[model samples]
Target chain A: GAGVSQSPSNKVTEKGKDVELRCDPISGHTALYWYRQSLGQGLEFLIYFQGNSAPDKSGLPSDRFSAERTGGSVSTLTIQRTQQEDSAVYLCASSLEGGAPLHFGNGTRLTVT
Target chain B: DQQVKQNSPSLSVQEGRISILNCDYTNSMFDYFLWYKKYPAEGPTFLISISSIKDKNEDGRFTVFLNKSAKHLSLHIVPSQPGDSAVYFCAATPGGYNTDKLIFGTGTRLQVFP
Candidate 1:
């Protein structure tokens, strides 16, 4: 796709259930990022992948959250035993290279009941 | 600790006027900054950016000014139009890139009235 694309525009799940969000970045973009915005809060970083380097997971809120980017194109963020507090709009973005302006996907709005 | 903050939650401006959005950061290590615009239910769109090497950058109707000493930055949109109404976010990183992650402000909602 010409722009970053995210699947399941909206997801509604019960607490304690597992959920997976997917992202397909712009073709040839080397950097992909995951962020979430809770109600009335700023965008919180979740994970980042650049090329073949190890992803920086420092921004992940808890151990229940994890992500992986396969072949440097598509990425998935998984939330385990989701709690109500884990609910947020999950956003994905990609840039041509490091330090470049990012192109973003519409985002997946995850709701935990 | 919140590293980035947008003190104002909302602002209203008449069409064809100038709209100024402010942001403050506490991380002195940050060298890059960017502005993003978002409409409801959509992802943020990159608007403009400025590196620490320069204090000001302008692109057509948009301009970004940085005050390194005060750790503050402001985005100016000239001749604001109704279509410009949206939530604006300021983000920063140590290297001013997207490698690690960007610290983001809470966001300011700007409404341009006709």
Candidate 2:
């Protein structure tokens, strides 16, 4: 693909339900990241991956949040028992390597009702 | 507290004027800073970047100024155009080359009126 792509551009789920957001990064990109942006708020770092190394999950807000990058390409971010606070735009980005300029995707706007 | 801060939430400028957006960071470890432009419902696109080694970096109409001592950075768009109206984000990565973790700011919405 020419750039990073995310699926389900918009989502609305009842509170307590689980949601999975998907990301398809640019071909050959080894690094991927997930971030959450609330209404009128800055991006909140969630998780980062570099190759097969242990994902830097330190930024995950809580146990309900988790993400994984399979085969170093496609990635998924899952939120369990979603709450109203979880409603936000989930963004995905890919780069040749971590910390470099990233190519972003049109994020999934998840709204927890 | 915010690690990367864009103090001005919004700025309005006339077309053909200069649009100056500011960002401040507390971490001296940040060696690289980047600017991103975003339109409604779209992802942010990389605009320009500046490494800590240099104080200024310019790409055509966009220029970035970094003040290491003050921990401040500014983006200047000369002769701003109406098409330039969008939210601008400032990002900083602490580690050196090719790393991926970026601390981002709240973003500033720039409105360029024609």
Candidate 3:
């Protein structure tokens, strides 16, 4: 891909429902990251996957938030029993390697009604 | 606690003038800082960055200044253009070995007017 790609640019889900956001990182990118931004807030790191290493999940806000990267290429973020407070933009980024400049996707705007 | 802070929520500047956005951090361990610009409905784009070892870094019309003592960093845009209007975020990382996660400030909305 020319750049990082995210699916379901916009999502409106009811509270307690589950939602999934997908990210297809730039081809050959060795590092991938997930972040979320609330209204008028900064980017909040959620998780990171580097090559075949164990993912760093220390930043996940709660147990309901989880992510998986398959074959080190595509990734998915799943939110279970979403809450109203979960309404925000979920962003995904990729870099050539750790400590490199990140390239971001437009993001998935989730509206929990 | 917020490790990074952008006290000013917004800034306005005239085209052809300089636009300065400030950021402060509480973590002294941060070794790398970056600036990002984002427009509505679009993802943030990397602007410029500076390593802790250097106090200043310039690229074309953009410059980043870091003051390690005060835990402060700023991004300056010379001859600001209307197209430069967007939300700017300051990010930092504790760049030792493979420390990739970035801590970001809330952001400052810069409006460059003609």
In the order shown, the candidates' DockQ scores are: 0.71, 0.77, 0.72
Model 1 chain A poorest ten-residue lDDT run: A95-104
Model 2 regions lying over 4 Å from their true place: none
Per-model TM-score versus the true fold: 0.97, 0.98, 0.98
RMSD of 3: 1.1
Query: What CAPRI class is candidate 2?
Result: medium
lDDT of each: 0.93, 0.93, 0.94
| CA RMSD (A), model 2 | 0.9
Give TM-score values for chain A, per-prediction. 0.97, 0.96, 0.97
The order by descending DockQ is 2, 3, 1
Which is the winner by DockQ between candidate 1 and candidate 3?
3
Distance from true position, residue B87, model 1, in Å?
A: 0.2
Interface alpha-carbon RMSD, every candidate: 1.7, 1.3, 1.7
The residue-by-residue lDDT of candidate 2 on A19-78, one tens digit each, is 999999999889999988999888888999999889999889899999988888999999
List residue ranges in candidate 3 displaced over 4 A.
B96-98
Report the lDDT tens digits of candidate 1 across residue range B24-59: 999999999999999999999999999999999999
True contacts kept of 3: 0.77
